[model samples]
Target: MSERVEWDDLPADLRSAVEARTGKVVAAEGIADGLNCSTALIIETAYNGPLFLKGVRRTDEPGMAALRCEERINATVGGIGGVSPAIRHRFDAGGWTALAFGCISGRHADLGPGSQDLAAVAATLRRTHDLPVPDFPLPQFADRLRTFLRPGEAQILQGSHLLHTDTNPHNIMIGDGGGEAYLVDWAMPAIGPAWVDPACTAVRLMECGQPPEDALAWLGQFASWRRARPSAIRAFVDATCRHWTATVGDKSAEPSNSRFRRLLECGRTETA
Candidate 1:
C-alpha cells in the first residue's frame, strides 16, 4: 500500500472534492519532491485503489503554464497503451493546479544498474512517442537546449523524438508481473532530439549500479534506434550533465547534490 499524507497540505477545494468522491482521504505523502511538482501517494475508498496526487508548486507564471502542459500531455498519452496511469482529475483553485492519477502498486524498478530495463523503458517510450500530437503544444527541445546551453556547451540536435525529460528510475515503476514498466513525472516532457531522455536514464542508472561500459552499451542501443550520431549523443549527454550539475548547486536542492553528482558521473568523462 502507498503511504498517506496530510490533507491540510493539499489545496482546500481539491481535498474537499477528492474526499467527496473517495468518501474519505486515506493518506497523502510525498513521493518525489521536484522543481515542477511534488508527487504524493494518496489512497481513498471511492477509488478502491491507490492514487498519485501531483501538486503543482508555485513556480511563477511560466512554471504554472508548464505544469498545465504536462497534465495535458499525460492525458494524451492515455489514449495510447498507458502513460502514468490516466489522470483522474486536475484541480485548479486559487491558482494552484493539482493533478490526481491512479497509482499502480509496486516500487520503482531497480534493474541492477544497466540491465535490460533500458530496453524495456525504451520500448514503452517509443510507444508514447508514436502517440500522435494532436492539439496540445508539444515540448520543443531545440528551443530549450539553445536557450539553456552554456557558452561552451555542445549543440547536439540530430534526431528528434518525444522525451520524458526526466526518465530516472524514481519516475519509472516496474511491476512484479514481468517486464511491465510505467513512466511517471511528465512535468518535463519535451519533443527534442533523440538520446536526451535515454541519456538521462543512462546517467541515473549508472549511479544506481550499472557499470560505465554497460550504461554506454544501453546508450548505444538508444542512439541506434533514434539514428543519432555518436558525436551528437556525446554532446547531448554532456549538456544534460551540465544542466543537472547546475541544479545541484541550488541551496534549496543541496540535500540531493551528492545524488546529482553521482548521476553526472555515470558513464561520463570529465569532458564530453
Candidate 2:
C-alpha cells in the first residue's frame, strides 16, 4: 500500500473541483490501503456525509489508467448487491484525475481462524465470480501472471470469467457490524478462470492463520473450486510461489513465500 497523500497537498483546482460537487470539504483523511492511487481519502463534506476519494496526477499514465479502469468497473460491480462502493462523483481536470465513491463505513475484513467475517467474505467472492464481464478492455489474468511463470503454465489460468485478483483481507471490507462484506479497489482486475480468485484467497487465508488444509477446505463451498482441475490448481500454486519469490526477491524464505509453499504442498497431498 502507498503512503497517504493529504487533501491539502492536492492541486488547488483539483481540490476545488472535488469540493464543488461534494460541497465544502469539511474534513479529509488520507486512506492508506490501495497501492495505485497517489491520493486516497475519505472526506466529510458539508452537504454529504463522506465520500471516498482517490486521485493521481494526469501525467501519471499508469495511475490515471488504473483509476479509469476502477471507475469503469465500479458501475457493473456495485450492481451486484453491495459488492463494491458506488462511484458518486468523478473529476478530471487541473492536471489531475480523481474519483469519489460512497464511503463504506466499516473496517477491513479479518480472515483468521473462527472469524465471523469469513462467511461474508466467501459470499462476496461468490458475487465477484458471478459478475458480468464489462464490454471495456481488461488484461487476461494469465497475461499478468505470465512473467512470473514458465511459458505453458499461464494457459490453464485463462478464461472468460471476470476476476478481482487482489481480494486480500485488506481489500475486503466487513461492514454493518461484520455481517456485510464489500470488495474494494478494482484497479487490479482481470479476465480469468472462475477459480482464480478463490485460489489466491486460499493462500491469503493461510497467511491470516488458517492452516493450509483448512484454507483449501474453505474453498470447497464454491462450485468453481470443485470444477477446478487439479493440474490447473497445482500450476497456480507453482506460479504464485514464483510470484512471491519475485515480489520478495532474494528473501525466498519470506513468510509469504513460505505460505504459498505450504499451500502447494497441501494441494499435492490432496492429490497424492
lDDT leader:
2
The segments of candidate 1 whose C-alpha lies over 4 angstroms from its true place after superposition are: 1-5, 57-63, 93-95, 114-119, 147-159, 223-226, 241-272
RMSD of each: 5.7, 2.4
Tens digits of per-residue lDDT for model 2, 185-214: 888889988988887788789988998888
Give candidate 2's error at residue 242 in angstroms. 2.1
Q: Which residue runs of candidate 2 sit more than 4 Å off their true CA positions?
A: 1-3, 79-82, 264-272
Worst 10 residues of 2 by lDDT: 263-272
- Each candidate structure's TM-score, on Cα atoms with residue i matched to residue i, is 0.74, 0.91
| lDDT (tens digit, per residue) of candidate 1 on 1-272 | 22223457666776777666656776556554445554355565455456776665454565577667767777566524765677777676644566777777766767465365666777776666666554766646755665446554434563446778777677787766676678876767777665566666666766677775676566566534345554454455445445555766556444333333433333434343
- What value of lDDT does candidate 1 attain over all alpha carbons? 0.61
Candidate 2: RMSD to truth: 2.4
lDDT score, residue 26, model 2? 89
